[model samples]
Target chain A: MTGVRRKSGSVPVSLATVAAAAEVSISTVSRIVNGQTHRASRETIERVRGAIETLGYRPNQLGRALKRGESRVVAMLTANLNNPVMATVASSAEAALRAAGYVMILCDTHDRPELQDEYLKAMRSQAVQGYILVTNVKSPGLAEFVARGEPAVFACRRNPYASGAFVGIDNVGAGADAADYLWSRGCREPAVLFPAQSSSTIEDRLAGFSMRLLELGGRCSKAEAPGLSHLDVGYEAARSLLDRASLPQGVMCLSDQIAYGAHRLFFERGLRVPDDCVMVSIDGSTLSSWLAPWLTSVRVPYHEFGRHIVDLLGEIWRGEASGERILPHAFQSDVSSDFE
Target chain B: MTGVRRKSGSVPVSLATVAAAAEVSISTVSRIVNGQTHRASRETIERVRGAIETLGYRPNQLGRALKRGESRVVAMLTANLNNPVMATVASSAEAALRAAGYVMILCDTHDRPELQDEYLKAMRSQAVQGYILVTNVKSPGLAEFVARGEPAVFACRRNPYASGAFVGIDNVGAGADAADYLWSRGCREPAVLFPAQSSSTIEDRLAGFSMRLLELGGRCSKAEAPGLSHLDVGYEAARSLLDRASLPQGVMCLSDQIAYGAHRLFFERGLRVPDDCVMVSIDGSTLSSWLAPWLTSVRVPYHEFGRHIVDLLGEIWRGEASGERILPHAFQSDVSSDFE
Candidate 1:
């Protein structure tokens, strides 16, 4: 430990100190230490090896990863962690990534484009190997990152502008299923409640629901409002719908949050579910079962998202082309007759 | 990019290549690049500076941070991100840390001591500057890390074996408030439902609740069940209570998730809140208002936790001693007379 000075409680011996002790270049020391001894002479390798042992120089894993232009770190940029749907997706992905020997850095964007951009830049500077974006807002930084062929997988909500790896349920199919269920329940006219800030998931669900409702010879009306949270959006949208006309026989909520907001408004108006208006929504989260009326909604296979997204990222890392993975969805209800 | 060979699409120029081109030690190049040039002569600094420009070497922030034995990264170990309470704490803390110019790496320990240990080791290797632990499980690794004078702040759940900084509501006081509310509702016989796996939060709340109940000349019974999620714990505990004896006139759920599960069980048993039995619970999350019959709860100031925890971490970083910070909580109910 001649060249490397160790204080009572100080930082560990760095590579610079090892190089200095071995009287060789840092690259030579690093190559020898990392087991790339063929690049250096035998005498130099032995000297560096001896110096490493004498100084107890442990290679920093993060520093090594930086030098190799790769890391076992994946960053997940979630729009809203407080949203149960997003939380489930993030937690599941984290577990899968951890199992695959990758540490996940979760960043909550709060559905703000600026925050998403900031996190993307910050994670890039940290040399994250991949990204799992639950992005709803359009972010230029994300689009550029994906365009550069970086390993990025869109979960739950896909970026409309960029064509990259995506893993989620078929939103249109889920919406069509909701429409069919509501129609089979002897409801003709139905109202769909959604947030004003549109996303691919919302637009596709709206398209599928309206198309299927028209095919069933039933008219569908949409109500939307601009709000910070989905709950507020649903509450305001429901208020608008109630203010204009009478309650429809059936209703479709774009999300579980939206459904809760609308249900609260309905409860305030003394309108009961299945008796006054049968309601159907997407996102079969735990909230559906936790609610009193037991919301009949289309269930997204969120638990499977982690494995699928991680597997897709593995493919991307192997120079595979972009792909879309759509998991299966089913209609769930404690009372089956609610849809009959 | 004269000294550096830039392919069509290849890795960026690293510090090693710059050092090689400068014909100086990597430490010299790093020092000059990081504006720590006092250690090197002016001529050597000039050579390294010229090489850096010619090689187009952009320093990796993470690599620099590693060399300095510090990082602007904080790792948060959450018990269960699927739990809305944990989600709120994590998301709020993320936002606060981000505003303070720090990146947060969130890991869901899922209430497993082994997982907590794994994350603690993994984060340590990553050279995270601090930790925010929402840990419930007793982890030996965590205790050792804390004992070694690491910067860690416990959120919501405090570790029984370690003395460290904590930022959360006073669970004992909140529990006493719940008991007082139940007593005011004229319910003499009260039942408290909690999870089988114990944590400081649960233990403190139960202690406060029972102590205050006895002071009020009322008796309290406890129900517990072993389950993976708090919801299942409440559901199974309620079933056990129902099968063994008659339903109590008042029930206290340890958390909002527990309340939802117990309320579902009550609904299934043809009982109603505030009518057949009065109910009170802690964790006044969004779930409280989302439920059909608005749950009377003690609202933990979750939104304030992020700021306080981040600020406390700042104090620890500045050589401040370990301190405990307890936030305030209040009783929330849409109908005040529900307690009266």
Candidate 2:
């Protein structure tokens, strides 16, 4: 122990070092170290034990967990942190995990399945306790891990194949609310500007809005944004819409980021919100109000989402439940009240 | 090994389990497990080895690193992720660390020194190789850790006590540029809206702007925002400014987030940018251009900062350099060309 303590600032002492110092077989040394002395003679045990004390080697948590089967660490997989909404979710999730005595290691896959797989593999090798996903798309190998009875929770997004706890907003209902607001305001021609992605949340929002608008005797034209970036898509979509002979009286944006882009284009084109057209979007991030004309958005209930995600995680942690919690959404009217 | 494998999904195999299976002393088992077998006899080594295979006990990375005295993980401590600048820095830093074969763990301090200290302790317990700080204030325990010869780097902010590697921008120069632009636009009276914090960057920017404006034959008045949230501060500051008999011809905002709040207040007061008052702020985040009549800002060299931070970390990792890198800031003028 004195020798080990003296060299503490240098490389750690290993089991082999102890065995070499004790003049015993590695197996006999392992038995002596693990307290299974029935096989080892007393004299052999003392010598090996003395060597361990002399080496000052301590067992690592990872090795110790080989007996516990769990590490006090959780891996959070996010598509990207560039989005303010994702940042909010991440902050909330991290705080919750920390409070629960688990360290969170965040992995940004940059919306790539390969990266997600790589991170998952790394986390598995480390034997993390569970996973928390803030990804919109399905991650490879995630289903297999969950199938093997690993604890997992999906926040803000759904996994079609996994049977795990989920906490998210009602995207379809939020979309319908947006359409209802525009239609009730006497918008006969409404348009949908959505990113070209297969996200269930985005699809549900578009579906709910389209269905509601159609029911209100309005035809909703759909325009697909060209890229994954909400801002770029909104800009490109708006540019294409401007090229048309007629513009829609109302536009429903899929996200606040998209709304910002579309709003910028509208401002540049000398069009005013609610004067020439109106807009309703989703994801009521704090930045939603940062723009000149605050967006009329379906407030995604981020706080609620954050709370329920942790609550549901507790359920999974305690093995009490593995179900979905669909939080509600509300439409906030920050756009001008007057209608032509 | 078979015994350990059978209970793999349940519990891990401990040193004691391996020792009992090998019929050796715990100390002998420890020595063999840690690979310190030089002292162990050939027969004892074979016995301990046989027991390890029979128990199916695998040593974890932490155990392996007990000999190396460090883990392959690096902890990144950030004040907050809500700031877009922070998110960009994190993404770049993560990529850099991954390229160098180190896993990065993110911990949000929420601008709280207590949280910073807590995370620092946790990372130390985990035996992380180093730290990367994105905080504006000095975190407790950080100074001691660096003093002990541990590798650490500050990104976007610095700790006064530690002579560690730092990567940040010239806040004073950026502030002077803002003042110069607004003054050159022939604005005689200038006002400042800033967050009330003891941050060195904010202090330098305020000083640089105030002093330079004074040198340019103009007076600059300052207003402190209400709370820590930059948006609220900007809003409150703008409201107070608007309450006066007259407003300044140009406004210098401390940050883009603050500018957003001020912009909202101005929009509500029917005060248009460039027409009512030209404005300049720090942090050229995407939102800077998302607003109507995009804000003119002292673009933080986030990409440059990120690159240099990683470069410096590489130097620290290689034990080559331990110094500071001050990247220059550029003023992006989108507030109108007539400023000159």
Candidate 3:
């Protein structure tokens, strides 16, 4: 058979030539090239291998794609593809998806609820058998999809709209844990930083921590009303906490993202973490992990979130009720845990 | 007709209910829900809209999944979902795909050539309509896939393994341009800081800069080859560059990532940017825009790359010759004729 001709052109090397060099059938050559296992015995594999060594017969993905219609593909959706936490999740998810014989199509919704809704419909048009939604989208549309038997799983944030099964840490319990830790470490007044109206997870966090602290008997006064998870909001919240002079001994941020912004402000104001003011956050992202002495964070088994989502989607595709599979969220404290 | 039960649980209103309330058909409700220009007359639209509003009608994507027998999901193969560059590309691509009624399932191959093979098979099983391989994978398997009519559009990174439609900047030219810029600024000697062989794009950058400077009657050398495209590499590379007794007056990097790294190292050592060692890099990410005064870079239009891939995929789906659509490498410099 004719092979791809070289641009410079002498006779282009062909599979036939490789077959001739290896003294095997063209079928055998093709088998080795295609990475087809089982049919070829060890001797054939060895002979073909020897032939491949001589002919440099590199099997390619482009050819396999033609026979298969769609090259390895899976549609993956997340809030921000760039978010280090999500990135880690995507990386791990890719590995798991590949292992399960799937290719992923990744999309970043920028955490936009409306955009998430649009993407849900758009995903339908592409015929994706499985999907993973990693956003704080509170759209009822998504819940409707899940109710209708769409194979999807939620990560990072849960869908308040109840579109599909969720595969995330117990945000509410995790936030309560964060609060308990901060308060236990000699913290009195505190704040829970998060966006206004993201998902039930955010509410869960707020309620978990505030209610826990309230139950623990700390007079809780919210210094800042909930705001977008912007660095500005974090900075301002921290600043106001300082300005009020009634500064709480600690502030519980909804996520590592919020804490990062708040940390900068805390640092610039000549306040040391855990010393002048104690700060705690969820999400063990690289940023918080690398923060000077490192910030205390709740490690939410982020990578596992990916694996669990894949497992859930697979089960769902097989018509199983995965129900609501929740991942374990743990608390981790390091050198940054100590407050002066 | 069953709607998502709100937290308030008001019998879960839906579009069907809205239609029932408005005494209209589901198509009319769908028209209102989709916001199509196929007008239902102002009063009709308003009545339908009012009923929908009162009913809290949210479009359920999963409801249509059974009828369509297609999830309309696309698959994406990404090299690095953690990288800001990759994330930006993902965001744009996701938006475009969604706009065209497609949801992307993203997988991060972790820049592993071996995993690319694993992912290829996965794509096939998913019945993905197309795949967007976003990698700098220069393995032979890539060529195999392209040869097979896989309906693939490369988002960024070209691999020697596959030859077909690709979208990326001229890294080599960009490097050469960096070299030229440094040379023109009275820098007799310049060294390029580059990532190692993990990425072909970095290799391309180094090759382009090294060859161009060598041809331009100057001496060029590598600063350091440590990690991937990052400020970390630049930092270590800067250490090596500084360790050299005869340091080059200007430093060029394969990417803004490396430049940032090197910048910090120089700053740490009491050297100022451009005053002692001018730094230039490629991939004008937003970090380059906001970090300090400014870092000279050859910026790639990331969003355009996303757009180009989608447009190409659309063409391929429609049986167009998208295989030949390749974007030329771009070079941006402070001394361009367009520069003010």
Top DockQ: which candidate number? 1
lDDT top scorer: 1
TM-score of each: 0.86, 0.81, 0.65
RMSD of each: 6.2, 9.0, 10.1
DockQ-based class of model 3: incorrect
In model 1, the runs with Cα more than 4 Å from the true position are: A1-59, A333-340, B1-59, B333-340
lDDT of 3 by residue, B1-340 (tens): 5785322112335567888899988888887787784777878888887787776566543344324433355677777676778877877787788678776767676677777765665554444567787874755555556655566777657645556667777677777887888888887678877766546576777888888888988887766665544656777888887897566788887767677667766766778788877878787774333223346777778866767788877777676666543455444434322312
Q: lDDT per residue, candidate 1, B1-340, as tens digits? A: 5787332123556788988998987777877887997799989988888887776566676776866777788999998888888889998999999999888888988889899888887887777888898885877877766656667888898866766789988899999999999999998989999999999999999999999999999998889988758888878889888888898989999988888888878888888887988889998876567564557888888978999999989988887775889988987646323222
lDDT of 2 by residue, B90-135 (tens): 8778877766766778888877778887887677656677778887
lDDT of 2 by residue, A1-340 (tens): 5554221123445667877888877778767767898998888888888888776554445554545656677788888778788888887887877787677778887777777777776766566777788773665566555556666778877875755688887788888899888988788888888887657788888888888878878878877776757887887788777777477888888988888888878878888886888888898776666564546887776755656666776777676857998887776554433211
- By TM-score, the best candidate is 1
Could you give the fnat of all candidates in order?
0.50, 0.35, 0.30
Off by over 4 Å in 2: A1-67, A292-294, A333-340, B1-60, B333-340
- Residue-level lDDT of model 3, residues A84-196, one tens digit each, is 67777877777787677666666677777677766665554444456777774656666666566555677766755554567777777887888888878888777666655
Query: Global lDDT for candidate 2?
Result: 0.75
